[model samples]
Target: MTFGEKIFKYYQQINVPQDLPTGVEVLYPFDSTEVADLTRSFYMRYFNDKRPRTFLIGINPGRFGGGSTGIPFTDPKILEEKLQIPNTLDKRHELSSRFVYQMIDALGGPEKFYDSFYFTSVCPLGFVRDGKNLNYYDDKALEEALEEYMAGEMRKQLDFGGNEIAFSLGMGKNIKFLKEFNRRHNLFKEIRPLPHPRWIMQYRLKRLDEFIGVYRETLAPFMPDFHK
Candidate 1:
C-alpha cells in the first residue's frame, strides 16, 4: 500500500479512548471528518509516492498545533501558508511548528525535507487538562494507562519500514521512554535525541540559529542523497 493509504488506514483504526481521567480532554483531531480528510489529502499530496523516510517522533500534539491540524507539529497557519494545505481550524502559531519549518527550510524546502522524513508522535493523539496541553508523561497514571496504546501505534508505523533510526524530539522524558521501549521491543536501530523545538523556541530563543544548526548538523548524515 502507498504511504498515504497506510497512514490513513492507521488513523481510521485508531481507537481513541473517551474515558480519559475526569479533568482530561483527549483531542483526536483525526476523528473529525474535515480534519481527517485534510490530513489524508496532505499525505496524498506529499507522501503519495513511496520512498524511504526517517521517522521523527514527538511526545504528543498540542492544542493549537497538531490537535487543530491533524498533522504532527503543524499549526494551522503553517499548514495553509507553508504546507499549502488549507484548513478552517483556528489559525494559531505554534513555536514548535515555526522552529520545525525553519529547520526544514534550512535542510531544504518542505518538498525535499518531508520527502525524506516523516513526523509522528509517541502518543498519536493529544490531551488537554484544565485548558492546557498535557504530555503523556505529565501524570504517571496517565502514562501507564497509555503505554500499550502508544506501543501499538508505534508498531503500526514501524511496519512500514525505512524507519531505521528514529529521532526522539524531546531529550528528557520522551527519550527516556523511547530508549526503554526500544530496548524492550527493538523498534529502531537507533533513537537519536534532539532538543524539542518547543523547548528551543521557548528557552533558547536567543540561540535559535544555533539550535537550528544543531538540527542541521545532526540530521545531515542521515539525509537522503538528493537532500545532501
Candidate 2:
C-alpha cells in the first residue's frame, strides 16, 4: 500500500472514544477526500520521499489547532484563511499554536520545516474540561490513555519506515515518552528535547535566539543543509 493509504487506514483503525465526561475530540484531517485535499496540499508535502528523517512529536492536540483542524499545531486562521487549508472541525481557541506558527515562520515557515520534518503528537485526540481543553498533563486519566496513544504512534512510525531522529516539542512529557520508546526498541538514532515554544514565547521571548541556539545545537547534525 502507498504511504497515504497506510496513514488513512491507520486513522480508521484507531479506537477513538466518541464520548467522555466533557467530550473527546479526534480530528482526522485525512479522513474524507475533501479534508484530505488540505491534508495533501499542506501535510502530504511534509512527508514525501525527499522529506527529512525526523519526527516532531507534541504532547497532544490543542483545541484550535489539531483539535479543530485535525492537523498538529495548525492554527485555524492560518489554515483556513492564510493557507486556504480546509477543515471540517469547528472553530475554537488555542494560545500556544500562534507562537508555534511564529517560531516556524522564523525558522523559514512550513515550506522549509515540512521539507525535512513532519509534526504529530503522542496523543492524536483532544481532551476538554467544562469546555476548555485540559493540557495533556492536566488530564487525570492520561497515564492509561497515553499508553494506548503510544501504541498508535509506534504503528505510525513503523509505517514511516526509517526515522533518524525524534524531536519532542517540550522538555516535559513528550521527551519522557520518546526516551522510553527509544529504550524499548532502540529504534531511533537520537531523541532530543527542547522547551515548548509556548514556554519560550511566554517566559523567554527576549531570549528566543538563545533558546533556538540550544535547539539548533541539538539538531545540528541532522540540519546540516539548513541555513543559519
Candidate 3:
C-alpha cells in the first residue's frame, strides 16, 4: 500500500470512546465528513509514494488546527492555501501551523519536507476541557488511563517503517512524558526535543527567523539532501 493509503486507514481506525473523563472532549475531526474527505485527499495528493519518513510528534491537536482540519499542525487556512488542499472548515489561522509551515518553507517547501517527514501527535486524537485545549500530560489520571491507547497508536505508526529518530515538539512537559514513555516502550532510538511552535510564536516572535533556523539545523542532519 502507498504511504497515503496507510495514513488514511490509520485515521479511519482511530476509535476514542466518547465517555471520556468528566470534563474531556475528544476532538475528532474525522467525524466531520468534510474533514474526513479533506484529510484523505491531502494524504492521497502529497503522500502517495512509499518513501520512509522521519516522525515529528506534537502534543495534541488544537481546536482550530488539527481538530478542524484532520491534519497534524495544520490549520484551515494552511490546508486550503498553502497545501492547496480545499476544505470547508473555518479559515482561522493558528500560530503553531504558521510556524510549522514557515519551517517547512525554509526546508525546501512542503513537497520535499513532507516527503521526508511525517507530522503527528503523541496522542492520535486531541482533547479539550471546558472549550480549552488540554494536553495529555495535563491530567495525571487521564494520562494513566490512556497510556495503553497512546502507546498502541505510536506502535501503529512505527509499523509504517520510518527513521527511528522522533522529534518532540514541546521540550517541557510533552517531551518529559515522551522520554518516560519511550524508556518503558523503546519506541524510538532518540526523541529530540524542540520548542513547540505555538510557544515560539507566542513568546519569541522577535526571534521567529532564529527558531526557523533552529528547525532547519536540527532537521537537516536527518535529511542529508534537504537543502539541495
Candidate 4:
C-alpha cells in the first residue's frame, strides 16, 4: 500500500478509545462521512506515492482545524481555498493553518511541500476538556494513560516508512514530550522542534516572516529537488 492508503485506513478504522477519564471527550472526526471523505481525498491527492516523507508531529488537532477537516493543520477555509477541496465544515480560519500554509507557500506551495513532508500528531486522535481543545499532555493522568497508545501509533506510522528524523511542531511541552517519548522508545534518529504556529500567531504576529524563514531553512535538507 502507498503512504496515503495506510493513513486513510488507519483513520477510518479508529474507534474512540474506551473509558477516557471523566471530563475528557475524544475528538474522533473520522466517524462523520464528510470528514472521512475529505481526509481520503486529500491524502490521495498529495500522498499516493510510495516515497517516504518525514512526519511533522503536532500536539493534537484543535477544534477549528484538523478536528473538523481530518487533516492536520488544515482548517475548513484552507481545505476549500488552498486545497480546492469543498467541504461542509465551517469556514472558520485558524491561526496555525494560516501560518502553516504561508510557510508551505514559501516552500513552493502545497504540491511541492507535501512531496516531502506530512503533518500529523503524537496522538493521531485528540481530546477535549470542558468543550475546549486539550493537549494530550495537559493532564498528568491522561498523559500517562495515553503513553503506550501514542508510542504504539508512532511505531505503526514509522513502519509505514519515513525518515529517521522527525519534526516536533511545538518548541515547548510538545517537544519535551516527544523527546522523552523517543528516549524511552528509540523512535527516531532525532526529533527536531519547531515553534508552534499557534504560539507564534498569538504572540509573534509581527515577526511571522522570520519564523517562516526558520521553517524553510530547517526543512531544506529533506526537501526533494523539483521544478518551480
Candidate 5:
C-alpha cells in the first residue's frame, strides 16, 4: 500500500476516548479521514512522494478541528457538507470548525493546498478542562501520554527525512514542543513560526490579507503540482 493509505488505515485502528461530548466539557477522540489525511501528509511527503518541501504544525487537535475533521484546522460543517467528508461527530461547542472551513475557502480550497503542503499537530488527541474544552492547556496528563505515542510513531515514519521546511502555528507551548522535537530528533531542516490562521481570522480580519500574503510567500517555493 502507499504511504498515505497505510497511515489512513492505521488511523482507523486508533481508539482514543471522547471524554468531553458537549458544552466545553467534551474531549472528542481522534477518528476518520481528517486524522487520516493529516497523518498521511507526514508520511507521504518524505516516504511516498519525497517532494513535499514544507510542513506546518499546530499545537494539537481541537474538538471541532482535527478531532472531528481529521484534517488540521478543518471545519466540521464544511468538511462534511462542502468537502463531502463525513464528520462522524458533532462535539465541542466552542471549536473553530466553522472558521477553519471558511479559511480553507479563502485559501483556495482543499484540493488546491492539500496537493502539496501538509498540516499536523504536536499532540493528536483532543483536550478539555473543568467542563470546558480547553485548548492544548487543559489536560496535562493526557498530553504527556499522547506525546510519547506521537513521537515514537513519527520517528519510525519520518526518520531522517529530507530538507523539508517546517512551520508552527501559534506560539508558546506549540513552538516549545517543535523546538524540542527538532533538537531531540532533528525532524526537519528548519522550522518557521506563523500565527494560527484562527487567531488572524478571529481578532484581525483586516490583517488576514496580510497574513495570507505571507502564507503565499511561504508556500511559493514549495507549491506542488496538483495535476500529478
Candidate 6:
C-alpha cells in the first residue's frame, strides 16, 4: 500500500483518549469533512508512492497549524500557497509552520523534500487547556496518562514503512522524551534532534538561515543530490 493509504487508515482509526486531564481538550480535525478532504488530498498528492521515507517527529500538533489544516507542520497559508491544497481554515500564520515551509524550500521544495521525509508528532495528537495550546509534556499528569498510548501510536507510525533513522524535531524536552520512548520501544536506530522550527522562529529568528542550513546538512547525507 502507498504511504498515503496507510496514513489515511491510521487517521480514521485514532481516537482521543478519554482520560485526558480535566481541562485538556484534544484536537481531532479528521472529524471535519473539509479537513479530512484537504488532508487526504495533500497526502495522496505528495505521498502516493510506496517508498519508505524517513520520519521527522515533532512534539505534537499546534491547534492553529496541523490541528486546523490536518497536515503536520502545515498552516493554512502554507497549505494553500506552498502545497496548493486550498482550505477554509483561518489564514493566521504559525511560527513553526513558517520555519518548516522555509526549511522545506531550502531543502528543495515540498515535492522533493516530502517525497523523502514524513512528518508527524510524538503524540500524533494535540491538546489545549483553557483555550490555549498545550504540549503533552506541559502537564505531568497528561504526560503520565499518555505514556502507553503514545508508544503504541508511534509503533503504528513506524509500521508505515519509515527508514531506520528518525529525526526528533525539538532539541530539548521533546528529544529527551522521544529518547525514553525509543529506549523502551526500540523504535529507531537513531533519533537525531533538530532545533525545532518554533524555537528557531521564536528565540533565534536571527539565525533562521543558519537553522535551515542545519536542517539541510542533516538531511544531506540521506537525500540524493542534495544542495550543499
**Candidate scoring better on lDDT of 1 and 6:** 6
Q: Candidate 3's residue-wise lDDT over 1-228, tens digit each?
A: 988899988898887854457989888878778887998888888789988789999998989999888899999999889988877778999999999999999998888888889999889889999999998889887888788888888898877767878999999999999999999988999899999999999999999999999999999787767757
lDDT of 6 by residue, 1-228 (tens): 889888888887886776888989998888888988987898898889898889999989998898888789999988998788878889989999999999988888888898789999999888888999999999999999998899889889888888999999999999999898899889899898999999999999998899999999898677765653
Better of 2 and 5 by lDDT: 2
Candidate 6 backbone overlaps, count? 0
Higher-ranked by lDDT: 3 or 4 = 4
User: In model 1, which regions exceed 4 Å deviation?
Assistant: 226-228
lDDT (C-alpha, whole model) for all candidates: 0.86, 0.63, 0.89, 0.89, 0.57, 0.89
Instruction: Give model 5's TM-score versus the native structure.
Output: 0.70
Give candidate 6 misplaced runs (Cα > 4 Å).
225-228
Off by over 4 Å in 5: 15-53, 86-108, 137-147, 156-163, 224-228
lDDT for residue 217 in candidate 5, whole number 0-100: 63
- lDDT of model 1 at residue 104? 91
Q: What is the alpha-carbon lDDT for the whole of candidate 4?
A: 0.89
Clashing pairs in 6: none
Q: After superposition, how far is residue 89 of candidate 2 from its true place, in Å?
A: 7.0
State candidate 2's TM-score. Answer: 0.76
Q: Residue 112 CA error for candidate 5 (Å)?
A: 2.9
lDDT tens per residue, model 1, 77-138: 99999988787888889999999999999988877777778899989899999889999999
On residues 1-228, what C-alpha lDDT tens digit does candidate 5 reach at each position? 554555455455654533333444434444444556544554454336334334577776665566655656665565557666554556343234454445445556665665555566665555655543465544555555455566665554343232457788766667777777777766777778877766776878777667777776666556555323
Highest lDDT: which candidate? Answer: 4
Off by over 4 Å in 3: 17-19
* lDDT for model 5: 0.57
Q: What's the C-alpha lDDT at position 94 in model 4?
A: 93
- Better model by TM-score: candidate 5 vs candidate 6: 6
Please give me the total number of clashing residue pairs in predicted model 2. 0
